[model samples]
Target: MSERTRIPPLSPFEEQAGFTRALRAGNRIVVSGNVGVEEDGSVSPDAGKQADRCFALIREYVEQLGGRMDDVVRVRMFVTDIADADAVTAAFSRALGHVRPTGTLVAIAALYHPSWKVEIEAEAIVGDE
Candidate 1:
């Protein structure tokens, strides 16, 4: 079995929820739902801006796990409002267009925080890369 590695989350919720933000087993890395909220607890109401922040945080985790954005093979996005799909898609494309990873968008009733508008998760493979 490959050794599993994990990264701490920016929020205390990770501990409360009993989960890590990122995990790696061998060359495969899995990133948990990344929200747009900053370390200072500020959240961007705009879906696009929120998506941007989520993607950036995911990228940081990927790199920390010995991978790159280009290594991302799958992406999942969650939004509170379906109308914000365009904004979320635009931000996702802007960040990972060249990678062209398989993606899914989901509409959820709510999130951990009331003000949060978007969240994202990703999977990456970086075998010997």
Candidate 2:
């Protein structure tokens, strides 16, 4: 049987809302959608900036669990504005350019927060260190 692990969300509200930031089983790790909102509850206005923050959060969680950005095998992006695609993807690419994980980008009608232009999710696999 494979082992399972859970990484708690950064905020108590997230815990109360019924979800964690990430979950892992064996070598596979799945991170929940991450927004640019910081610990102080501040969000960026630009999609690119938001993407940067999201990737940082995901990278942190992945590394904490014994994995690296290069280990990421898949990525998904939820973008509020189609025009912001370039900015969002640019940030995503910068974060995983060498790794180049399989990915998809979606233009959504809106997000939980109107100011949030983008949210990102990532999946990674740990292989022999």
lDDT of 2 by residue, 2-59 (tens): 8878875667887788887887889999999999987778988889999999999999
Top lDDT: which candidate number? 1
Reference-based TM-score of each model: 0.93, 0.92
Candidate 1 Cα deviation (angstroms), residue 74: 0.3
lDDT of 1 by residue, 2-62 (tens): 9999986656867898898999999899998888987687988899999999999999999
Error of 2 at 76 (Å): 0.2
Instruction: Write down the lDDT that model 1 would get.
Output: 0.92
lDDT (CA) per prediction:
0.92, 0.91
In candidate 1, stretches whose alpha carbon ends up further than 4 angstroms from where it belongs are none
